[model samples]
Target: MDAVQVVAEPRRREILRLVWDEERSAGEIADRFDVTFGAVSQHLRVLRDAGLVTLRQDGKKRFYRADREALGPLAAYLQSMWADRLDTLAELSEAAERAERGEGTDT
Candidate 1:
């Protein structure tokens, strides 16, 4: 699966966030959630398959870390797309606030 499709799963997204800045063992990653270690491992496998993470083996432990450089293209595209959407959301939210305040009423 592609990086975008792999990350579309919220659990996988959470896992990504956990290891974004540092490598963590499979057990460590599993501890962050209530799910089974196998479940987290599966997510890591998906991420690895998508080139979003790198796995290292160390004496019966598997460590996973975010492979951000590998996702440069997708990240750039997502940033551009979200920047516009986030700006629109902010504007709409501000408009709602103004309407809720009755157009600058002194109350």
Candidate 2:
């Protein structure tokens, strides 16, 4: 799945958020979820495929961390979408205010 798909899943996003600042071992992440370690591992695999997270082998443990650059596209996409919607909503609110004040014209 793509980054968008990966992040859309709440569980996967939680995992990403947990590891956003620091690397966490797979076991550590699994502990936060209600599911089993295997389930968390599947979520991690999806995030890995989307390039939103990377894994490293530290001795006998597997550590995962967020990949900021890999997530840049998702950030840009969300920002642009919010910007457009916010601009439209602001314009509508202003028009509503003008109509309420008898300043808006049918023409």
Highest lDDT: which candidate?
2
TM-score of structure candidate 1: 0.68
Kindly provide the TM-score of model 2 when superposed on the true structure, using C-alpha atoms. Answer: 0.68
Q: Write the per-residue lDDT of candidate 1 for residues 1-107, one digit (tens) a residue.
A: 77778878888877877887799999999999998988988888999988898999999999998888987776666456557877999989988899998796345
Cα lDDT computed for each candidate against the true fold:
0.84, 0.86
Looking at candidate 2, the ten consecutive residues that score lowest on lDDT are 73-82
Query: Once superposed on the true structure, which residue ranges of model 1 sit more than 4 Å away at CA?
Result: 76-107
Clashes of each: 0, 0
TM-score of each: 0.68, 0.68
**Top TM-score: which candidate number?**
1
How many residue-pair clashes does candidate 1 contain?
A: 0
- By summed lDDT, the worst window of 10 consecutive residues in model 1 runs over 74-83
